[model samples]
Target: MTVPAPAADGLPTRVRIHEVGARDGLQNEKATVPTEVKAEFVRRLADAGLTTIEATSFVHPKWVPQLADAEALFPQVADLPVDLPVLVPNERGLDRALALGARRVAVFASATESFAKANLNRTVDEALAMFDPVVTRAKADGVQVRGYLSMCFGDPWEGPVPLPQVVRVCRALLDMGCDELSLGDTIGVATPGHVQALLTALNEAGVPTPALGVHFHDTYGQALANTLAALRHGVTTVDASAGGLGGCPYAKSATGNLATEDLVWMLRGLGIDTGVDLGRLVATSAWMADHLGRPSPSRTVRALSHKEQ
Candidate 1:
């Protein structure tokens, strides 16, 4: 298939960025970021033209103590012009989120049993079953739900996952009324070949490609390559974090999600318009990295800063 040419304006006409830095990014941090800092980060992200930001998770504080402030923080930024989605681990988490007037929530699952058990404390079937009530309740309450499937490419414990397993979970999520499904390369082991093959399998199974999204970590530095493969298959929505903010706690040495600035830069180069200001996003990422006392993991940020120097 011939890749489409760049737009007349020298960018793709559109792209969607789901910012998870605030929630997934900070969830594993050793230090608890003050509520004010989290709020400020969300506000700055909105100002950077991000329409979908994963603000926080409402799971039990014991599992992820960093996001214990979801309730307190949601109300403070309820007026922002963006979909601030919080991760809801179960019905109880859903209840907390609903109390805070959450309009969007995400449910997560894993393809492998071991990862599922370690991360979500359930088997694959059990985890998907848990979402039934959560999705139903969220839909009834007029809240949109997004589904996430981790270990789409390969699992650290289970090795490479079967294509049918990924397709089945995806179909289940979509059938359960999830607005979208984000296929995650949790350990960053997906290659362009695997991406193409899995997407093809998903499409053949009657799944709508547009309703599918890809989330790649740069552990193997293949996030961009996998993204290109997804785009080639007409997959529209992509999940990325600013400054490359999140990593898998279960997999040591694994890097965070694909960087938003880098993703935006690539999309712009391919003529896709993400509606994000590249320079502003880079600056915001830099500021956050500084505030967090760590240099950004984004190659785009490093390159741009180097160019300026």
Candidate 2:
């Protein structure tokens, strides 16, 4: 394995990698991964130095049966000294997460009416309306909330989402008391310029860079590039999955997320500290790939693990 020499670009000194392998990554699995396996996956991700790992979603089993064991799984890894944010679709999901002592929760929103209807069976504003009390209650309880704005860049149904539309929903989430927002390129259609433009637009809309995180999918192989553009614009937090293990369950065109190993490798090369152990992350994803009976899709994971083989 070759480590790229540290080359400090005009980027943040340290970036936070929000690990989503356990929750978003596994939610699309056709076979139900045992609860114990999911628990171990989260544990290993924490051990690999990912500070914030999304644990599971509280969505109904009818919607995402893969994470039906959120109750059984949360307590299993709750003691770990890390941020285990769970996804809560509505007030009901928030209740389930708070019951298990989850301190951080995220609400999934869409930037387009098409995705809003397809995923949540509501209009864009209606979905945000549903999350209004959920965010309010979570903030009232002192729980940190993250607003995940999916289809921020492009929608499979409505191609090329408008920037103002994205900024509007983002401001609504922030005004509604979300601690931060994760802008999701749900279909992986964003380019570097699009990423920068959106960030600038968000900043002009009074959504500070610190309050934003970028979640890019690799369906178009542009996640890393888009991330670089964000970093150059003073955004530090990035959302990725170990071994690149995730896709939108509602959007069939969506593909695996930006791989944690791939993101770490780029950040490490650029002399950006992420507090992640690339070796352990690759190993963890490899272990999970074995569990799923498939090869990991992450290029860096494959490259590093192949050298060991």
lDDT of 2 at 284: 98
Q: Which candidate number would show the highest TM-score if scored against the true structure?
A: 2
What tens-digit string does per-residue lDDT give for candidate 1 at 138-214? 99998999999999989888889999999999999889889989999999999999999999999999888888889
**Which segments of candidate 2 are over 4 A away from where they belong?**
1-7
User: How much does each candidate deviate from the true structure in C-alpha RMSD?
Assistant: 3.1, 1.0
Question: How do the predictions measure up, each by TM-score?
Answer: 0.95, 0.98
RMSD of 1: 3.1
Among all candidates shown, the one with the greatest lDDT = 2
User: Model 2 misses residue 303 by how many Å?
Assistant: 0.6
lDDT value, residue 116 of candidate 2: 96
TM-score of 2: 0.98
lDDT of 2 by residue, 112-136 (tens): 9999999999999999999999999
